[model samples]
Target: MKQWKLGLVVVLGISGLFSGRAIAAEEIILRYGILERTVAVSDLSQLAETGEATSQLQSYFDTAEVPAEEVQNMLNSDVTVDGVNINRILDNPLGDVLLDEVSKSIYPESGSAGRQAMRAALVLSAVDDDRITVIEVLENYPTSRVVLDTERLAETYEDFQEVGGVVVTVEDTLDDVLNVIRILETLSN
Candidate 1:
């Protein structure tokens, strides 16, 4: 009976991990000018969690114009987010503009699905912790492949702050709304 219960739990856990989503982003293609390098998402995640960059990622680190510490700060910083509010915000006009700006920097290979994928990534990342970090967004990205345009990444990071601020404001304003956000989040999905 014990063994059977353990097997069932493992199966359920695995199912929950994937749910109905596509394969999460595995690698990011970083592009700068004519140069491009494919980096594993796992390596980036590790570097964000721990401050050490691996040998495989070292060369890219060396070539980066931004200091390592700043890079770490950007990756490690996070915002409290709600999936339902994120969904609602991204469907509006201002959100569309923000998405356009952000999408120019980090997007899937297709390019067109940038906003949708970004929304999904942000929502999925916040599902468990209500905290969304750059690393988590990259990890939960809805595509198996993603692109990071170095020229625009820093600028996009700034634009992303605006969206984060909006989320914070919404959280403050919507606090006493009687759990409507939670219900909307489910219905939106």
Candidate 2:
């Protein structure tokens, strides 16, 4: 009787474990450049809590040929191409053409640095417009730059009041800049 009772209990326990509710999963569509992907996430909260979402997102960006790190660096740094400082050209009437030329000169290689340089060049070209300079665009749209650089512009200015004002002004236009970067990356491949 004791042996039979132990066997029954073990069987019941095994069945109960297997009968537990299944985890619910949802499908999310992510668009990167020209590529679109649909991923099923079983537990979003769990993934976020574990900090695995970032790695998953990074893998997606890698598939799209846009190294997230490189893009981040390019957006943060002061970039110059073909002997012309991008900031100086931003205000010039011929900035668009100059930026295009610079983009063309970027080395066509698959390495992370090369790909990043190419993306940066393309982003600069995209921002080149006759109506407004990059600074003016940022100034007009205050929240846009925050999307690109969550930490905000890291560069410090000697005149905090004047330079800080300029940074704030440009913040609004950062979205347009990012849009241009996305468009260029999409069309490149």
Candidate 3:
């Protein structure tokens, strides 16, 4: 009787472990730009947990065939990473409007892809016209957030004299950027 009980307990434990993994591996739609990516949520969580700086989530973004230079520039900018003070730039009326506009554009009234796009666009729109002259939003990590320095990117291009509204379908706003980071931190926990 004791042996049977022990065997049953072991089997249950193994089953529970597999079940947990399956749950983690469940497919989830990650939105960035005008794109909806169906991938394993567990994979994103794993990338976040490992503290891998590289956007392992890029594979999903690639489906949209976004320009490589644009993506690279956005990643290299300040908004892409964490621990940057964007409070001053984002705390303005224009900044707020920019975020709202992007939100509406990407989310629209329906469609999962549209909603995801809007979510991504919100952050893309926040790029400070002064700092980030140009921008490119790549991926959305449910566990980790990325911000685009649109203001800075604009500066690099001579044609873009004024930074605002230069990068279409990108969310580079300040508050939006911070909010996404907050979400990432929450997911990480």
Candidate 4:
């Protein structure tokens, strides 16, 4: 009888974790080029969380100018045990292009999912310069600090350097909001 009771409790606990409204609302803002857009941060339960979404999200990070290995770990990670999502900040036209491409690629599987990711990416673009300058991609990383030394990642550097841009990542685990701002700061002196 004791074993039965314990089993029931475990089952109930597991079910409770899975059973919940899929729609999660969050407050966030993104700026791309000179346009700033405000949007609610939430995950669509209807979409059903899947590895494909994780893979797609990773693709953006993979193609980025930063270290591929580090980026991969970050995107495919659920660092926060509390169910909080990490935020990534990518700077410049490349960042904008990445979001656009992501939206286009994911349109068939899920329009809403693509839009949400793009919207999130756009929120990070705090500048509307139209020209590709600096691209800072900051993510809300988990407690575990992952060192992605940009200097070490040469192949990736070659890919991004062709376009002339750099991505700086900042990790803030506690913050519920993953906000990133890419500013042109100054023109070539």
Reference-based lDDT, residue 135, model 4 = 22
RMSD of 4: 19.1
Q: How accurate locally is residue 171 in candidate 3, as Cα lDDT from 0 to 100?
A: 44
For model 2, the run of ten residues with the poorest summed lDDT: 142-151
lDDT of 2: 0.35
Candidate 3 C-alpha lDDT tens digits along 80-164? 2211222233346654544444433222223333333322332332332213312222222111222322333343333322323
lDDT of each prediction vs. the true structure?
Answer: 0.74, 0.35, 0.37, 0.30
lDDT of 2 by residue, 4-72 (tens): 434533443454346451211133334443555554432223333343445665677567665655434
Q: Rank order by lDDT, top first?
A: 1, 3, 2, 4
- Compose the digit string of candidate 1's lDDT tens values, residues 1-189: 345434533543454367554447899897876778898998888889887777767777677655656666777778777644565666778778877787788899878779877766776666666677888888878787899887787778877776788778877787857587788888999
Query: Can you rank all candidates by TM-score, best first?
Result: 1, 3, 2, 4
What does the lDDT come to for candidate 3? 0.37
RMSD of each: 7.9, 24.9, 17.0, 19.1
Among all windows of ten consecutive residues in candidate 3, which has the lowest summed lDDT? 133-142
Give candidate 3 misplaced runs (Cα > 4 Å). 1-35, 38-63, 67-70, 78-89, 102-189
Runs in model 1 deviating more than 4 A are 1-22, 175-189
Give the higher-lDDT candidate: 1 or 4: 1
